[model samples]
Target: MTVRIVTDSTCDLPRELVERYGIIVVPLTVIFGEEALLDGVDIDAEQFYRRLAASKVLPRTSQPSVEQFAAAYRQAFQAGADAVLSIHISSKLSGTLNAARIAAAEVAAEAGRQIELLDSKNVSLGLGAVVLAAAERAVTGADLASVLAVATATIDAVHVVCVVDTLEYLQRGGRIGRARSMLGTLLNVKPLIHVEDGEVAPFDRVRTRARALERLAEFVREHRGASRLFVACAGNDGETEAFIERVRPDLPGTEIIRGHIGPIVGVYTGPNTLGVCPVMPV
Candidate 1:
């Protein structure tokens, strides 16, 4: 059976890998003032950041509609995909999964094809790792059940920690969840946060960005045996490179993939956000 992998834009997988693996990415919407642009398509990281700095109003994000997902599923089936493992970001964070689930049910009932939905319970490269892993398995001709197993296992094993320059963007985006308490002294410290069980949680707090970077490297060091490692930045070219260099010693010979936190995730994390994500073995 030909199993295809489908993920939302929040997966944060690189463009090359997306094309190479035939991974389908459904985009979320980012609203800037009166403009509603698709995450990766209509608006890119650079443009979003420029507008964000100049505009007085904070941008808002919206999940994709069911129709959009349904169309994607139809296209996949038409392309001869026997089944689809429609993995997505955390349902707690957005209604994207609900839309996918609703679309899956409709496709199942109407077309009699299989569509299994998996929630990464993660964002950014945390989500990217899982999608890429599942896609690797699928490209090896794994059945839907096997591919779904790999996906869920990756979700359970993956770990992600991010340090945003400020918590205000998160507060404004309303994705703080259990991490809301970090807001009590937002101005006093830099927050070290992790996405746990689909909700943002405080991992630690450091008085300086320097200390935060150290803690991030230590976090990666603690998970050195992961299947892969990824470092993401929100347009901090120098910071991102320096961070990778600092963290590389901990990873030993492991090759860490470099990526950007794109406009979709950047809208909430803001710029200068750097994160470490590890994809551990199931």
Candidate 2:
């Protein structure tokens, strides 16, 4: 049976990779003031960041409606997919996976076919790695179950870490979650952070921004067996180069992809966020 892969925009997969792999992406909405723009579609990374810099208030993110998910699944079926392997960002981070699940159920019942759903427990390139892994399998003519197996394995092996320029964006956007307490105390210090169990948590604190980036590179180097790595920067600070320079020595033979944090994630991560995501083998 032919299989198709579906993921949301939060995966942060590069556009070329998404097109080459034929991965169907349903976007989340980013509400900037009165205008609600589709992530990566109506409002691109450049546009979002520009608006973000100008606006006094932070943008709000909303998950795609159930009907959006259902339509995507229907399209998969229409494309002659005998089965679908749908993956999404962590439910704890957003209600995306829950919407995928409900839509999968609705589509499954009506189509009388199985629509597999997975919770990636990751965001950004961390989630991108899993979707690409599954898509690779599906492209190779693997069945739905086999593709799903690859996805699950990739999720287990992947590790992600990021650095926030300031706590202002996360705090203002109200996505600080567990890092809330750190809000008042160390507002001056740069935060070295990671997403664990799908929510943002502080990994370390450094007196300077450079040190936080050093810690980020060290975190990537210490992962031991990562096969591929992704380095993403959100802001136009030209820090992506600096961050990649520190990370490249350790990443030697590992495949690396560079990304800019898009508008939706940037809403919470704020401007100038840098992240390194690695997917290792089991």
Candidate No. with top TM-score: 1
User: lDDT of each prediction vs. the true structure?
Assistant: 0.88, 0.86
For residues 139-173, could you state the per-residue lDDT of candidate 2 as single tens digits? 99888888889999999888778888887778877
In candidate 1, what are the lDDT values of residues 160-259, reduced to their tens digit? 8999889888888988888888788867698999999988899999999999998988899899887689888887879889888877777766768888
Supply the global lDDT for candidate 1: 0.88
Error of 2 at 54 (Å): 0.4
* Candidate 1 positional error at 185, Å: 2.1
Any idea how many clashes model 2 has?
0
TM-score, one value per model: 0.97, 0.96
Candidate 2 lDDT:
0.86
After superposition, which runs of candidate 2 have C-alpha atoms over 4 Å from their true positions?
none
Which regions in candidate 1 have their CA more than 4 angstroms from the true location?
Answer: none
